[model samples]
Each structure stands twice: as structure tokens, then as C-alpha cells.
Target chain A: MSVDVKTVKRVAHLARIAVSEDDAERMTGELNAILGFVEQLNEVDVSGVEPMTSVTPMEMKKRIDVVTDGNKAADIVANAPATDENFFLVPKVVE
Target chain B: MSDLTRLTISQARAKLHGKEITATEITEAYLSAIDRANPALNAYVAVTGDKARDMAKISDARLVKGEGGALEGIPLGIKDLFGTEGVHTQACSHVLDGFKPRYESTVTSNLWADGAVMLGKLNMDEFAMGSSNETSYYGPVINPWRRSRLDTVVMPTTHQGDGGFVSAGGTKTQRSLDNAQLVPGGSSGGSATAVSAFLCAGATATDTGGSIRQPAAFTGTVGIKPTYGRCSRWGIVAFASSLDQAGPIARDVRDAAILLKSMASVDPKDTTSVDRPVPDYEAAIGKPIKGMKVGIPKEYRVEGMPEEIEALWQKGIAWLKDAGAEIVDISLPHTKYALPAYYIVAPAEASSNLARYDGVRYGLRVPGKDIVEMYEKTRAAGFGREVKRRIMIGTYVLSAGYYDAYYLQAQKVRNLIKRDFENVFAAGVDVILTPATPSAAFGIADEDMAADPVKMYLNDIFTVTVNMAGLPGIAVPAGLDPKGLPLGLQLIGRPFEEETLFQTAAVIEQAAGTFQPEKWW
Candidate 1:
């Protein structure tokens, strides 16, 4: 319900963003405000109401389950920062 | 010929068909205008002159063979968010600075198939996260109309005027004066600017939360957000998947119609793309709105709304009434909850969609001592402040313990908002009319965005409901605010009912005497 600075910092970390202590404090405040605003939704009565997902009641269109990629590996990898042995190379994960 | 550059796509198509001008000439003219105006406006991230010329040559050959499509030889701008095969699609973020997709998006491919020439990729908010175009790594696009005539000759400020001046009056003033730079609106700000300044005839744009319409509104250009499934999302870099829809930003309704037709197509690769028939959007144009019920939602009249916007809404309603449209007062009681719901749902989806870009897949990656470090270093170095902030908030809402309270609850509310629209339309409200934004364009120096995200989010207030409802909405250039910047009136229609929306919009355009840039350009 209430997002504290610690929780905000944890969120920033999980999101892979670098936020300073001051920014964490600020984000906490903003998040609290947003939460406060969202809290208003709790006031509306919907005892028998169904939560709507889409305006139109149409179902998601079905597509073929087959997989036949164009196999443009070289083309797809052309934009990567670094590649080795036809694979994207990243820093070593294990020590 | 200079005047021809300001012509709508339909007008251009007619001229191209008649051989009054060659595709090469039109493409060259737009390229030359981009050359002249881009430096002042900063609208494009890259200008593909060679590709454009080559495409024009092909279009010319098609014309010679009598194989011209609707968009044949028409020059257009593609937003950087749409991946171009060889052209860089950076999402306006440094994180993917050199990231170019090996494939083209279905929408872009469709445009190319229709023989539309690419003027190059236009600027946008970094990863389409911000409402203002300011977050782009390429710097904000200055509205070309702002610069004075002398400024244009000397420093390219020839069209620069105060932020809110109407385009027609501003253009007249610009003609008499020296060079100055005017404000093109944001996200699709660059595209809108390019079209407004006659740098291009039209530009492709994406609307997540009014990115197309808001900028279109600010720049006095026509922008449409078609039904969500109408355009394929396969090649487009994801930004709030459920909400993002690629559309066109053009000078007029007919051009928007043409661009929409050119862009809409079914793609098997994008499962979300509809397999339904793509209609002749242009044929829907000029259809009579007589006896059509137009709803004016009283709930959209938020407190503290500027009187100017209200006056424009009243004037628009009156105009539609005189044109045989039945004006009905309606209520979307859940309208106020839309902004909050959108902020929650869009970011939540964005978080999931963007998770793939975690430094290893295919974007900018910073080498680090470890894999975890690689992600942190890469993301910290790559993403802009706004993007980072969004991802953080998004992750927070979707986290384990918070999921039910935030993410699930928001999803439930999203349904309520959607049903509100369904109820009204079922009640005989053909289309809903509201102000596109609470106010007009703000200054570049405005730091209020940092202080108040809610106020900033309110810019999408009128537009996001359409997205939430998955309905079609168009921002018509209604009138100007006191500051003289263009304010738009939004017409929202039922799902897949773009024809009705465009017809109603055309009536409003005719009645309002919508701003035409050619008269000024």
C-alpha cells in the first residue's frame, strides 16, 4: 500500500536502474501519490459487476501453432554489440 | 512547386497520376525541404535520402507501368520506434544506439508496398515512455513555425513564434518576418513538425497513450489511432503492447485516411494482428454524418480546465449540430479513473515487454565483471531517466506480494473503464467528443513535469480512454487556446468504426476550417 524509500530502492535495483538515495526518496513520494490516487478506485461499488477487459467482446484471433522462422540469424545478429560463434556474447555469468 | 510540398497525400497522388510531377521530383522536393528545415527543427534521427530517391525511382517506374498504389510516390516519415531493415531503430534511447532491426515492421512494409517513400526515421520520446518529445537522445524537435523569417535565413529561427500561436496566423506572421523556430508537438513531435513545416507530406507514428494525437493536436496536424489489432506489432519495438498502435500523422483527414489504409495489414508473424479484411479507408471519407448521434461526455469536463478548451468543445458541438449530427450529453462516469488505470496497465505491460532488453539479447551492452553487473551497468548507462523511472514503477507494481493489489486490481478497473464506453455506445452514443488535452503545448523550459507526474499524465486524459476501450479516436484541429497554440477536439468511435469517426471528423474539419499548412508554407 505504502511504498517506502527502501522498497523504491529495491524496485530500482530490480528494474536495473541506478537511482541515488535522493532520487529513491523522491520516487517513494511519487509512488505514494500514485498509490493514493489509485486508492480512490476502492470507493466505487461493483458488487455484481464484472470487470471488463476489452470494450469489444470479441475473442483474440487464432493463429497457426507451427513454427517456421525465416532463419535470418546473420541478419538478426548484425545489430548486436558483440557476437561469438553465431551467438550474442555477454560477460561471464559464473566465477 | 513549393506549394505542392504542402499538398495532402491525396492531392499528391492525383498530381503524380497526372504526371504533373514525377515521384523523383516530389521525393527530391521533400528531401530538399528536410535539408532546409531539419537543421532548425531537429525532427529526424536520420534522413534516408538515397533510399528515398531509389524508392521514388521505383514509384516513377510504377507510374510509367500504370501500377501506382494509393501511397505511390508519397513521401512519409517513419517513427524511429518502427524497426527498419538497415536503418537504425534506436527507440530514441542510447541503450540501443546502433540497434537496427534486420527486419521491417509489417506497418512499414505495408507502407513501402503501397509505394510510400521513407523520408527517414523521425524522433520520439525515449522508448516512447514520455509524453513530451524531450526525452529523446537526439534532443527535442523545435516547432518549425516558431522561428521568424529572418531567423530562417540567418539562424533558422525564422518561424519561431510564441508556443500557442495558430498555424495560419503564425504562418502569415512568419512570411512577413525573418526566420524563427516553432514547436512541433511531442513523441511524434518530429513527424508532426516535418509535415507541418512541409518537410514531408505525412509521417508514420505510434500511439501508446496519445503519442500521435497529442503531438498532432499541438502541431495542428491530423493523427488517428486505429483499432489495436488493425496494425501489426511484430516489427515495432514494444512499448505497452496492449495499448500501442501504429498510425499516421498527416496534414489533413484524407491524408490520414490514405496513410491508415497503407499501414493496416494482417501479419501471420504477429499473432495479435487481426485477420479481418482491411477496408478502403478513403471510401469512408466524406460520408454524411447526418442523423448520427454524437455524445458529449460531461464527465470529461474536469475542474480547472481552461475556458478556451471548453469554448472550442462547445463550438465543435454546435458545428456538428448544424451539420445534422444529433448532440447528446453522455457520462463516462469511470472516465476519471482512466488515467490511473492506464498508468498502471501500460507500465505493467511495458515492464514485461521490455524485460527482453536486459543487456544480453541484442541491444547496447556494457561489459562488466559479472552477468548481473552487465545488466545493471548496461541498463544504467543506456536508459534515460524517465524510462528508468517507468520500469522501476512498473516492476514495483508487478512484484510478487504487490501483484494482486496493484497489477490485478488495475486490470479489473481497466475492464470497468472499457465497459463504461460500451454502455454509452449501447445507449446510442455514436461517438464521444472531448478536448484532446486539458491545455495546449507547454514551454521547453517547463520543469513542472518533474514536480507533478499526475499533471503530466493528465495530458493523455481524453485520449487514453479510447485506448483502454480499444476504440478508435481522432484528434481534429478544433481551435486555438488563448496562447494561440492549437487545441484539438477528440472524436472517439466504437471499436473498428474508424469510418464513422473519420466521417464525423471531416464534418468538424469542414465546419472549423481546419488549419492548412500549405497556405502558410
Candidate 2:
């Protein structure tokens, strides 16, 4: 389960993190080391064990699907690096 | 009394209630200490001096009216991970540079509601990722403690008095005064530093796989990570939603209990925050542990564990036994797999949790020709190396082909680990005891640890199993290593049974006297 540079590049792309060739090369080795450590999990027999999503087993509490709070667009956008009026300004998506 | 800044939370509360000192005076004392020590320690990234004074003034007024809350007039530090309205809440990372939330975290709001004053936002491992606090963008938090130098033994000198050159007693015992800057452990490193250095009465910290307890152990403070659903996570930045639980790092077990009582509450906003009543955790202190069963897990005896840590564990066992508790040897077979499984589950959740920070909304935004390119540029520049590494590891494991092999497999292993704790508890084991960490705090920016991420992740080895089981764990400073640095012993309790942990930890604290470093800063 060794990670190669090509796989590292793909993961970076999938993660939306721009990685240069040099960074990818270094990441290949680092990711491989992590995978090597995690590879030990293969030794344990987990055939009957259910994957635990939450440690405490409780039914997810349901709520009526209604917005209790909103409409304060200014407050939501207060920390935006670049917000125009009520909308967050970003590079044009359609263009 | 002693220095006003050195008062524990209980001590400060008594003084404030007795009108021996005003909240304003104590807050000023802490401010002066922070001014003097923060430059060397870098523990606090933002000091709310004016805000602290304003809050202290309000507390003083409340005391005058004979109507103050539980933690009235006590100043404390807030970890950067918790959101403080209009203050620095970046989690010590560049991604959230200049990002201040309009809302305060539930934990801090609870503290403020109890009349606790905020000293400032403390530094931490960036996004609570690293073990040594070096991952913090602000810089590494220099531990206030350094290894004590060996005592200088001097020979007796001859003195001539009336009795013609008789040998006199002149043995000089000089204490070691070495001043190398040791690390204050991580994730909650800033909180531990502030509390250990007496910069704050206590601090609010979150533990996702040992972040709270490890740092507490390293800095010789008391840290308790309450049960997973004990504290409301609303407004606290999400890391791993299932594992992240907020607790406190304080100067002692009672202070930790006091802070935890104020910090834990059920919130409608966080449905996972259980509706159980928050108990008087401080009251649990001094309760006898006679006839209680303390389980010593066999699997925690990993190879290469330092002799001091093992000795400390033995000392803790003896102390608990002397306090009238029965020691039982238990086997948590899944302990070894906890770390590997934790790495997967934590990162898998982190990658999802951190996806909110793109170029569009809040935080650092680097523009590019297109929205897609803009996201890549912003994230590339925004995140630190360790953060980026985790994101990539997360992305790779969660990718289309590898999901079952890595993410799903890790989740299954996590279940086994949890089941191990349940089995032990079901067998009449009241609480579990183990070392808090593999070793004492290492030097800041150790080259070997920084080079390899896996080596750094190993720091949480002792404390991660508690998180995997969603149980409460406390680190009590038990003894000093041969180097004179503090070493802590951990006690893991059953789910939602933080009271048991508090009682047991108090016994350990009573047996092993509190550790305080000489004033070097």
C-alpha cells in the first residue's frame, strides 16, 4: 500500500490543495509512512464488528425541517474576506 | 498571602468572596505576569486586557452586591479553537487569519455566565493537530518548566575558632537552575502553559484523542476530558465531531472539577450534547475510594516505554491501594490498534470538517482566474504543512477506491477498541489507570519528530483509547521525572461518570504532591 507521487498528486487535486511537483514528491514519502503505520490494522480480524460512526449509540435526534434562525446576511458575511453587500464575492463561477 | 497571580481557582474564589482582594487587582496581577512571561512563552496569541478589566469590574460590582456566580471574578484563558466573538479565533492557523466569529462558543459563554473573566485566546497546535505545539502558526509555546540541574554537593571546610582549626559543618547544597525551554505538550499546549505558568486560574480546552490530557500531563497541570456528550460543541470549531470534547486545564484536580462543572451543559444546538444533569464535580473530590476496583490494563505496557513512566504508574497503583482501593489487572487487547484507528477516523472527519474553509466565504481567500483555481490557491496558501498533510491523508483514504480499505476498516477497528473498554467496565472494574504519556515533554522543534508525522502522532498513544471509547479521562500530576520535570498518571472512567475520575484523581494528587517549576521567566 505504498503511495506514489502520482497518487499524491491526485489526492492533492481531489483535496483542492494545489501541490507543486516538489511538494508532491515529498508528500509521496510522507503519505507512504502514514499508510505503512496504518497497514498494521490489517492484522486485526474485524469480520463481525460494525463500523462505529458515533461512539455513543443513540438515535440521531430528529428535528422539524425548518429554519429557526437566518435572514441576518450581514452577520453571516461579517468575517468574509471579500463580501459584496449580502453575497460573498468570489471568482466568477460561470465565467 | 502568596503572589496574587499564583492563586488557584478555589483560592481565588475564596479571596474574591471574602473581599480580601478585588477582581480588578487579581486581573491586573495576571496581566502584569502575562506581560512579563508571554514574550518568552508565546502561550497567549491575544491578550484581552481591556476586556478582562471590564469583566473584572462587573464581577467586583456583583461581589459588592453579594450576588456572584460560581466562578465570580476569576480570570481564565480560552483556547484558540473556541470561538470568541470579535476576537482572534483562528485555531493558530493561517487559514482563519483575521477571522472572528460573531458568536461565542457555548463553553466560554457558560464560563462568562458564571462570572469568569477572559484573559485572552491562547495559542495551540494549528487546528489542534500537532503534539508539541510547534504546529501553531504563532510559534511553539515554550514550557515554563526546564530540567533542574543536579544539586552541587560541597565538602565540609575547616574553620579556626577558639579550638585551633577544627573541621566545621560547611556542606553547601545548591539546587539545579538550568533554563532550557521545554515543550508544554500540544493541542491544548497554550491552555496548559497559561495554567502552569499561573497566567490564568484555568483554561478551556478540547480533547480529540488526548489533546487536553497529554498537554496537561506534560505541563504538570490537571486536565479532565469529560464524556463525549457532556459539553455543548456549538460555536467550538469542529475537528472530529464524535471525539472532540471540551474540558479544562487547571492548576489542580479541584480547579479542574470546578471548571468542568461550569463548562459541561446540554445544548439544543448540539443534539449530541446529552440531556443528563451536570453534577457537582468539585464535590466528588475527597470522596473515599474504599473497596473500589481500579483496573490496570495489561496492554498499555508497550515496548520501549520509559522506566520513569512505568515507575510512575506503579507509584499511582500503590497510592490508590493505600487509599483503600482494590487494584485489579485487566486486559484491553484492542489498545494497540487505538492509535492507528484514531489517525484514520480523526483525519476522515477533519477533512470533512475543514472543507468549509474555501475561497468564497470567510477566512483567507486567494483569488485565481476561476472559482476552482481560486479554491486550490487559497487552501494551498492557507493551511500549514501538518494540516495539509492530514487533509491529503484524509482525502486519499476517503477517495472512491480506498474508502472500504482505509476509512471503513479504521471505523471497524474503532468499534473493537470501544468494546474492549466496555468489556472491562462490565466486569466490575470501576476505573482504569495508566500513564498519561509515553514520556515527559520533549524540547520544542525536535528535528526527528518534525520530520516524520507518524513519530509525532505517537505522542497520544496512552490517551487515545479513552477517546475511542467515548469515556472520561483525567491526567493528574503524580511525580517528577529524574530530570525534575513533572509526570502525570491517567485515570479513565466509565461513560458520563466524570465524578469517579475526579475522586480518584484527587487521591493521586493527595499522594503525589503538586509540582511547581521554579520562576525562570
Question: Per-candidate RMSD vs. true structure?
Answer: 5.1, 2.9
Best by TM-score: 2
Candidate 1's residue-wise lDDT over B1-521, tens digit each? 56668677888999999888889998888888878777767888899999999999999999988899878999888899998998989999888877877788898999998888998999888888777788899998876443123222222335655533334433423234223334455678888888777888999899988988998988888899998888888889998988889999888888898889889888877766777788888888788888999999999898999899999999999989988989998888888888887878888888778777767667778877777777877888888777776787789888989876777777777888887888998999888889888887776636777587676677888888888878889998987665456778999988888888788888888887666432233
Question: Cα miss at B303, model 2 (Å)?
Answer: 0.4
lDDT, candidate 1, residue B506?
Answer: 87
lDDT of each: 0.81, 0.91
Best by DockQ: 2
**Which residues of candidate 2, in runs, are more than 4 Å off?**
A64-66, B155-169
Worst 10 residues of 2 chain B by lDDT: B159-168
> Roughly what TM-score does model 2 have, to 2 decimal places?
0.97
User: Can you write out model 2's per-residue Cα lDDT over B136-194, one digit (the tens) per residue?
Assistant: 98999999888875553545475333322333465444456676778899899999999
Candidate 1 overall Cα lDDT vs. reference? Answer: 0.81
lDDT at A64, model 1: 68
> What TM-score against the true chain A does chain A of each candidate get?
0.78, 0.91
Give a tens-digit lDDT track for model 1, residues A12-86.
778876677888888888878777777776666655555555544557767667776867778767777788767
Candidate 1: regions farther than 4 A off: A46-56, B145-183, B516-521
